[model samples]
Target: MSNLERDPQEIRCGTEAGERSEVLAGREVPLGGPRAMKVSRTLPNVHRRMIGAWCFVDAYGPEVAAMRVPPHPHTGLQTVSWLVEGEVLHRDSLGSLQRVRPGQLNLMTAGRGISHSEESREEVLHGVQLWVALPGDRRHVEPGFEHHADLPVVSRPGFTATVVMGAFGGALSPATTHSPLVAAQLAVDGPAEIPLDPAYEHGLLLLDGEVEPLTAGPLLYLPPGRDALRLSGRGRVLLIGGEPFGEEIVMWWNFVGRSHDEIAAFRKEWMEGEGFGVVEGFDGTPLPAPALPTTRLKPRGRAR
Candidate 1:
């Protein structure tokens, strides 16, 4: 899903301090038009720009609506699409067309650059759209897409976890990643103790039902160190974590880059129809890049 905001904020994201836990609540943001579908944006919070390399996160739906997001460009990041309900048809510049449903994954690597469109194939949509800032060494590798219909699942007494991006309880996802990270969807039954990587900082977002000590809106951030997450309740939640990103990033609109000039160049290419290849199949025109902020963009480090 695109950032769709007419005046999107320029986010300077950095690594986590690896100190204590924090709870970041999401704010409601509309996706498109007047009667837009609203999503709760949890990452890139004023208090925290990122949880490891996980830069942006938007959770939406369980409400009735049709989502139509036109072709939008992205650079220096990978898009991770996961759904709890409904289906989304994805088409991209690489000439890839795939329909993603519950229990499936759509991973797009906007290496140097890539463009894509998303349309709801069902009325009620419930899911999260996330972005991982690629490290400098891998940021310009190549633009690509992956549709994983079968992913590893780890079952415990109180919950069942579907590994979406990285590894969990020895179960690893087939989706390729640039850095050491983890993303999983947990279906909580009663009470459970989930292990954690002492080296990777983590964040948990409750999607539905009730997970004790965790409600259905805010993202719970767990800094690296001693492990294990103990929760008692029945609900659904998303867990994402990674080694604290060693580098800082400048995020504007849909693009992620290092410096102000780098971002400016990306915007120029998108508006001029250059770098990012064209995304066919969508009936509507591509989304226009938002205007740059008057001041130069800067990188901010470790949101302590």
Candidate 2:
């Protein structure tokens, strides 16, 4: 029997109810290219505040872009860049330069601060960039880097799951964080249900093909509640969640934090040109200015 064919009640799951929702809305920003732009379509918190500590989710570069962003600064948050297709070269002020392709995960914990930039080498670069809000106590800690070459990749029946952070089933990632979170990807087809825990908040992005609740349009945010969810139809899906971050978090552009003042200060520093303080070991150039939005931060109301 396929792993997905097993009992849905017993399958290990995240804390969020495994429910599906329709892709309701999306916001797209043309990132200099006529076609290549930043799309904030997924993530329930995209237009608002944090849903369980996950903030500032962006999916870009399914198309070609002539321009690539240079080195930029970041502070008070952990930045994650995962590729689904194409390539991205990341250089930081700390002198770390890494070329990441698909199946590779780049996690930067800017505890105290750091500066970095992702430049696409080819015409097309597509992937997801997530900004995870750090706890106040760990916000100003030292910076670090964790890259996995032989990370565990598990396949079960209709799906393949990647353990990028925290733990999943019996496998676990080496990366450490203050919260209990799991980053996963699912590639599947036909009708199937994914069982999840009731304690964790969850969200899913349909990378290709289509599914109920989440059409191949935008990101779907699933609130915490039930223990299992069934995704019918076919295609591939990327799921990420864990214990819902209970803290109230705020997000503005690429910055995420628990307090508005902290975000404001980050803006002041960013405007003043103070990016995340890079590590001392990586081989790279200094940080550059961020690709700021054309307008100030918009109020997206409350998290659902």
Candidate 3:
């Protein structure tokens, strides 16, 4: 989904030191207008910015609501769409039209630029929309889209892990990733231990039920050096991590660029219908880019 805020804040993101585990709570943000659906934004928090290459994270509804996001532009990022409940129809500039349901993944690579829309006829929608900041070398690659209906699943004695992206439990997902990242959905039945890569910093978001040492509405961030995670509870959670994103990024509205001039140019291109192509199937008109801030955008290191 797009960052529909009228006055979006510019975020300068870089790597941070995480020596220990921390629980970071999310602030609620509305998606669109007055009746917009509110999502719990956890990734770009004040306490922590980027978790590896995984930059933006928004977890939304198991409640009754309709999602109608108009066609919007994106660049220097990849959108990872995962649903736990309900269904959503996705339309993009590449002429790809697909419906993503629970257990399925919709990965869109907005390498240079791309436009897309998401709509759901279902009464209730529940899912998480994530953005992976593309590294410097691959940021300008051609944009594309992928939909995976069957992903690898690792079933242990106490839990079942669905590998949404990257490698987990000796199983790897087919979804393409630009970095050494890992994303999985863990359905914990009782006590379970999850192995981890000591090189990557990880974060866990509780989706449902009660997980020991983890409550809903907050993300549990585990810094590098941990080899495993132990949990004894019945619940579902999303685990995401990777090698810390080393480069600084300026994120304003829907575009992720390097500087204020670059972002302003992107906005100008989108407004003039230049780089990001037309999204054909969406009924509504494309979303207009929000006005830039009065001052020049500045880059800052990661939040610690």
In candidate 1, stretches whose alpha carbon ends up further than 4 angstroms from where it belongs are: 16-18
Q: In model 2, what lDDT does residue 5 have?
A: 11
What is the lDDT, from 0 to 100, of the residue 206 in candidate 1? 91
Q: Tens digit of lDDT per residue, candidate 3, span 1-304?
A: 8998888887878765658788888989887766778899997888788898988999998887788899999999999999999999999999989999999999999999999999887478888999999998999999999999999999997899999999999999999999899999999999999899999999999888898879988888998888898998998999999998888888999888788999999999999999999999787899999899999997678775
Question: In model 2, which runs have C-alpha deviations exceeding 4 angstroms?
Answer: 1-24, 32-36, 44-48, 258-261, 271-275, 278-304
Model 1 earns a TM-score of 0.98
TM-scores for every candidate against the unseen true structure: 0.98, 0.78, 0.98
What C-alpha lDDT does candidate 3 achieve relative to the native structure?
A: 0.90
User: lDDT for each of the candidates?
Assistant: 0.91, 0.59, 0.90
* lDDT-based ranking: 1, 3, 2
Q: How close is candidate 3 to the true structure, as a TM-score?
A: 0.98
* Residue-level lDDT tens digits of model 2 in 95-120: 77787777777888777666666666
**Residue 50 in candidate 1, Cα distance off native in Å:** 0.8
Write down the lDDT that model 2 would get.
Answer: 0.59
